[model samples]
Target: MIFLLGLALLRGRVGDREAWHCGAVLIHPRYVLTAGHCVRDPNIPNLSLLGVRLGELNLTTNPDCQLGLCSSVVDVGVEQILVHPEYNRACLACHDLALVRLSRAIENLLPQIYPICLPLDPEGELGGSTDALHNSRDWGWIAGWGSVSGDPFNAQLPTVLQKAQVPLTPTPFCDALQQRYPDPSSTLCAGGEGPFTCKGDSGGPLMIDNRMRTRWYVLGITSKGPRVCGAPNTQTLFTNVHHHLSWILSNLRP
Candidate 1:
């Protein structure tokens, strides 16, 4: 569990039936990144983001353990919910980014509790060629406490956190989305063939694991996906993290 894993967003309380609403990625001791929709959604007006559970591996077990190792699940109340200023619920998928400030900082990090590295970019923009993302050799993975059965409409949270490796894909949605909002940045594409993310996976990170460097970099945030998850020839779109580096840096504070 040295890599990225699922963290659950709570609506009101820890065991509340409606707490397992979305996913997030810990980026700092006191901050986590998630979708703007997760922060505030018109469809779920009654449900509010109240807290988050970090280092949670299995839903059925407390102090989740595996292979003779255990993890400490920590719940931190939400101090603030900062949705992207440009995010529009009316548009649904436009600039879907946000940062949630935890009430307190995590003092220590273990194997099950760690932060994903941000992409190594000098300009806060995608330094690698767009073609690199589409290259067949490049690989990425997504993890979450989301639907394990790949059903978008009827999302069933797995007892244990789910993870899958998905290849980067090139899709026409980027162009279509850009045509509508030319000022915004382009998107990252992946996981059309199979093992793609679903509804509850939203706000999770689309990560690139670099074993050679022993560091994990978050490439994108899990954005919108097809109505029928894992549908043949359907690619998923993610919010490119590189595009919002400045915004992320500006808001990262204790």
Candidate 2:
């Protein structure tokens, strides 16, 4: 489920066509892992990315996608947008992460479209202290279309493609949420009290399921929470993708 696409120039109106403001992860076939404020928001002055929508699960009609009854969909057109060069729009989780790059190349692969495995650590260790994600299993999974009733002005978004199962908020409660949101030591705090992850589930993915569960290790990306999304102990913040995996394998281009 990928879908970034853009054209949110705002105020100066670039024709406003944002097919899915954020959420991505297709690690290659033309790369697409998102969230650097979904490719630079800086409080939104110009915005404007445009590209990414592989095997979508229904963003309200597409190739007749009655919510994952989907048969075909693959938008791809962004030819580049690599945010994290120490991204810091005043630290919502600095170095939020981004890497889109697709103008072509997604030759029909499915199981709801593929690509999502980038957490390796056989000693060439990088961030998040990987050892296949250390004491693994703090629980995961977090798909998105975002809001399901965390109403930031009536955001009832859902047409299928919204998963959740968070749990992983203990590093002294993410060090007390990095003392009120400083998060960037590679972030990584999950949520509680039933599902969480709102405002368009930022950069999507936070998977993890491999203990013979047959692979699925994405481990973080959705970055930021507590604007009342499932707010009961609140914890969201992601973006650890194994601590940038060497800045996402040196900006993946192949």
Candidate 3:
């Protein structure tokens, strides 16, 4: 997982920087995947891309950050921001994926700072023909340093990385909630009940366990949810990484 340390320049102040905003996932040694909105917006001015923080679990303090206790965290510089060509700020659900290229390739590839695998099959098959993600019983996890409360202005944001279990919403049910035509094939809906992802959780990965249950695969990217989060019967939508696999592969540096 990668935390986006967005440093937006203020309108008047030349060297002024704003706060860190969104989350992301490491998809390659130098490529990080996140929402297109996190990278650019036509309305917002003077906002510049800073970089990303890797192997980070806590944001507030490093109380027990040692060899065995915590993973070593490092902040890398951004070389480029690649938002999908079709990404539109007007449409929140369409083409929300983006990729960030680090200025330099990461040297330390530890368990905590490794890249997550993208889905190979359009149907979301994991190495085999079996569709592991088709069943609603197969649960996935979403992690981020987002605000615990629905209110964006809430000062009590979580310092430690938080995770929530979100079961895949059946396609029939998800399809019914489609607001636009041609219903985006590059999106997946989940979290009908229990804990749902909120603001600041955007661009985080929706991870599913592998067949052997040994490792997790990034199935989706956190996109949008109800205005009031965690509401019963409301499902959160994620940018389907499976559908965008080719786009991701094409953007990565060989």
How many clashing residue pairs appear in each of the predictions shown?
A: 0, 3, 0
Give the clashing pairs for model 1: none
Q: Give residue 236's error in model 3 in angstroms.
A: 1.0
From the highest TM-score down, the ranking of the candidates is: 1, 3, 2
Which residue runs does candidate 2 get wrong by more than 4 Å? 1-22, 25-33, 36-51, 58-64, 67-71, 75-78, 87-93, 99-160, 163-175, 180-191, 197-202, 205-221, 224-234, 238-254
TM-score of candidate 2 relative to the true fold? 0.32
- Flag regions of model 1 displaced more than 4 Å: 2-17, 89-91, 122-131, 173-180, 211-213
lDDT (0 to 1) per candidate? 0.73, 0.66, 0.68
Native-referenced Cα lDDT, model 2: 0.66
Worst ten-residue run, lDDT, model 3?
5-14
Winner on TM-score between 1 and 3 is: 1
Against the hidden reference, what TM-scores do the models get?
0.86, 0.32, 0.83
Say which prediction, candidate 1 or candidate 2, comes out ahead on TM-score.
1
Q: List the residue pairs that clash in candidate 3.
A: none
- Global Cα lDDT for candidate 1: 0.73
